[model samples]
Target: MPPDLDPRLTPARPDLADICLRGQVAAERFVEGRPARIAVPSAPLRRRPDVAAGLDTEAVMGDAVTVYDVRDGFAFAQIVRDAYVGYLPEAALGPADPAPTHRVAALRTFVYPAPDLKRPPIAHLSLGAAFAAQAREGEYWQLASGGSVFAGHAVPLGHTEPDAAALAERLVGTPYLWGGRTTLGLDCSGLVQLCLESAGLVCPRDADQQERALGTALPPGLDGLCRGDLVFWKGHVGMMLDAERLIHANGHHMAVAVEPLAVAVARIAEKSFGAVTSIRRLAMTAELAETGAFTPSAAS
Candidate 1:
């Protein structure tokens, strides 16, 4: 190892394992893809950090609620479900979901359902884990565990609505895994879809589908974007804010983070080598909006 480099960091990188939306573009052209940032429940590509690897370590087991925070050199997330909250990295799991609901009487848990592809019989979810909810009530929730929704616990602490603002803020630092969606990890459109769905909205899970759901087109510029507006390019998507910024769970930078809209636009432009695409409003059709369904794109 070179003395100039950090000692705790290793040289191995990560890779992708899956994609929720079929025929999605690669991470190399995030902005050009569509929603500038989405969710990826699959393990992402990246190198290992030796020193930060063991620093302030906390175990995120099954049925845990974690909140992604910072993403400087490495990804950082804290468990917010129950008592399991702290910092962890992005390279831990294969294809994690966003707030995946799982119930475990102990450290050992099982495959969530749709997530139970091979029917792992009793696949184990560690303590301090994460899951995406498909069903919910007072104390229990149905999640898209491996691929289906089984019963589980640990949803948002208080209320659960499909508010884009709240959902956008939730996945703040989630690592940008290639196919991950859990607090365990996330990607660009995956972030948008996950948080929106959790809020009670029913938008499409992919960027193009999202473009269809949004209805209105972004034109050629973003002069009138407000918070919760869906921003899309070619193969990527993200949330735009009145603060002249956008937030998305991206794979290029490899995590959820805020970026200047100009910088983001520039990055996408450079990558695609083309003009900016479209930006869509989150507001639903007149009928839909009148019904007060403009909370979140993923709200069901």
Candidate 2:
């Protein structure tokens, strides 16, 4: 077994492993996982089966997953989007079919039971949630899963945002929730992951992993920084709104907020987060791969 494999992203466990890793890992049983999709609005992927267990991340509507095991109402699965492995509620999953054709582009939107706006909402889909549109009414897109969503809030597959910084700007003031990934809440890395993924770039879920896998590192000292540059601290990450301003989902404000980069640097240092470890510039040169897998030393 390769010690470099990150447990957070690897599907191998002592008792079970994804069949793809049969030769690479030691497991009592290896199985070809069953395909599934997140049916609920958003489901927490927790580190353990218990409700009180720590949340690793979240899987939103239409996200694909491969279920390896089901026990105690929780399914041990690997999210196909990022290869993140965790346990999510079995009830939140539905058959993976009627492939998604559109992605929610709005920060948040409501899905109505009928095409009429007057109808009560059946569910709320956040940015990056996927849904297949089977038909279009006057102003609504009838979903393949039996609901209607405002057509303007979603875009056809392959449509990409112009830039991630602008997208991050629109999310300012959203509450900061550790392990969250939706507009409802999100942490530093989660915010980065959301914005980058929306812009058609692949991003890792944790700060350290992102620091390693993301764009080219700039020369030290934060000189010549521009919009969309990523700043990293040991356990934290933030994006440059521009040369002077920094935007981040931080605990200091408990919300996504902006401030001068120098001020943030000073305060963060005073609080013992250490200095900026690296500054990365996402050139957007690489396209998003069909499958995102990770190989990093276990950390975070």
Candidate 3:
């Protein structure tokens, strides 16, 4: 594989590659990938097939993935939502039919064996997880795969949250996880990605990709910072809560935390990540606000 091709996004290897890449790269063979959907509530996508390998990200229920190759118990696949390629446990996948019609909107929710909430839950789903709803029974939605989830916890696929910053702030105190994007645990980029998705914006998976592709870059300075502004370091990213505060999932706190931008900048600079590389502001939707700005008081 050429060094220029990012392995994180490319479904190619020296031995095999996706048929879609036939003309773009050299490989021993190319094959049309098989389509699959994530069956479990959440499955880790790792850099390597081994469980010990670093997790690159996660695929949630009903997410479409293309399986380019399978070995042992792992499938080398690419998630359609973000085009992220990694090794996922083969057991985590299922048939791609009965496509999703709703997505989990709550931070976390339970899948019950029956419509009754009193029943023991079978599985837990996190925000952004997709599911196919076959019918409504009382206050629960019957899933195509056989289960019921609280109807209020999910919304139609087209639904979107009004404020990205406020939505992210709801996850304050989420545990810092290297490659997780669930309420169970999450990383800096994962937090930003989830929040952006809630606001109906497409975002790339990693911080470096997010910095390079998301929003319009603002000239160097903290004076113009506002809610929804993305503050990026070399390998990390965070959202500004306002002109003075920033919220991020950080190893230093091992959780999502909010602090003055000046304090975070000085601490991060003195400790490890060096300094802020850029501050980019997202184009606000009309729903975000008429003035395209957010205040903590209003959210409260």
Candidate 4:
């Protein structure tokens, strides 16, 4: 059998082997290709079917997923965004729809029952949750989800924030939760992924994966650090706010925090993560260039 087809699609996650490889190794036939979409603001993708199981990632509202099996109240599925397979509550899914028209750009926003902000909210959406806009009412956009959101909070599809590091700063003090992607809680990689995704860059879910996939390596010293530069240590990552400071969601403070890069490096090395592995500078997207967020010196 091909190495990639040995029923372990994600070698890091052994728990999924049974579900992903059932047809090949057991008599149980695997179901294929049932389209679905996330119906909630954010849905937890767990390592197991139980609610208490360790979270693997999150599927935000309107994310496309392919269901391969349904058991109890959970669905075994693969997220279309990153091809990450996991289990999420079956109740959080609904029929797939066309691509969303806008995405929530604020840290959090409410979906009011009507166009009036005074009315009660029907749903609360987090940053990066995509929604289809059906119409405009006053200062609100009517969502296909049957609610209206403030127009200022939703940006047209393909609109991206130019300053990813500045966007991440807004999330300061957010509680750190493993596998969390919302403002309610976020892990290190989740923080990076959310900020970058809002800037229209695709990012992977885990620290190791992000380390492997993002940016070009810089010299092995703090001298090269700059705003938006990525610093990686074994199993952890942080984004530099400037040459002196970095912002990260970490278990040390148990929240997103900023500290002097040198201080953080010493503390993290002494206590947990052993040493810095690499320093990387990301390329500027066209959107960033227009906003002058990236300079020639910053890229180096």
Best by lDDT: 3
* Worst-scoring 10-residue span by lDDT in model 2: 291-300
Better of 2 and 3 by TM-score: 3
Query: In terms of TM-score, which candidate is strongest?
Result: 3
- For candidate 3, write residues 69-161 as lDDT tens digits: 998999999999899999999999999999999999999999999999899999999999999999999999999999999999999999999
How close is every model to the real structure, measured as TM-score?
0.46, 0.93, 0.96, 0.88
Order by lDDT, highest first: 3, 2, 4, 1
Q: Please give the RMSD to the true structure for each candidate, in Å.
A: 15.0, 6.6, 1.9, 3.8
For model 4, residues 115-159, the per-residue Cα lDDT tens digits are 998998988999999999999988999988788999999899899
The C-alpha lDDT values of all candidates are 0.48, 0.88, 0.90, 0.83
Where does candidate 1 stray beyond 4 Å? 1-162, 272-274, 284-300
- For residues 14-117, write the lDDT of model 1, one tens digit per residue: 22211321234222211111111112222222223334332222333332323232344334332222122223444443233354333222222455334443
lDDT of 2 by residue, 1-300 (tens): 588788998888889999989888899999999999999899999988899998889999999999999998999999998889999999999999988999999999999999888988989999999998999998999998989999999999789987787899999999999999999999999999999998898888999999999998988997767677799999999998767788999999999999988999999999858899999877652121112211111111
* Candidate numbers, best TM-score first, in rank order: 3, 2, 4, 1
Clashing residue pairs in all predictions, respectively, total 90, 0, 0, 0
Clashing pairs in 4: none
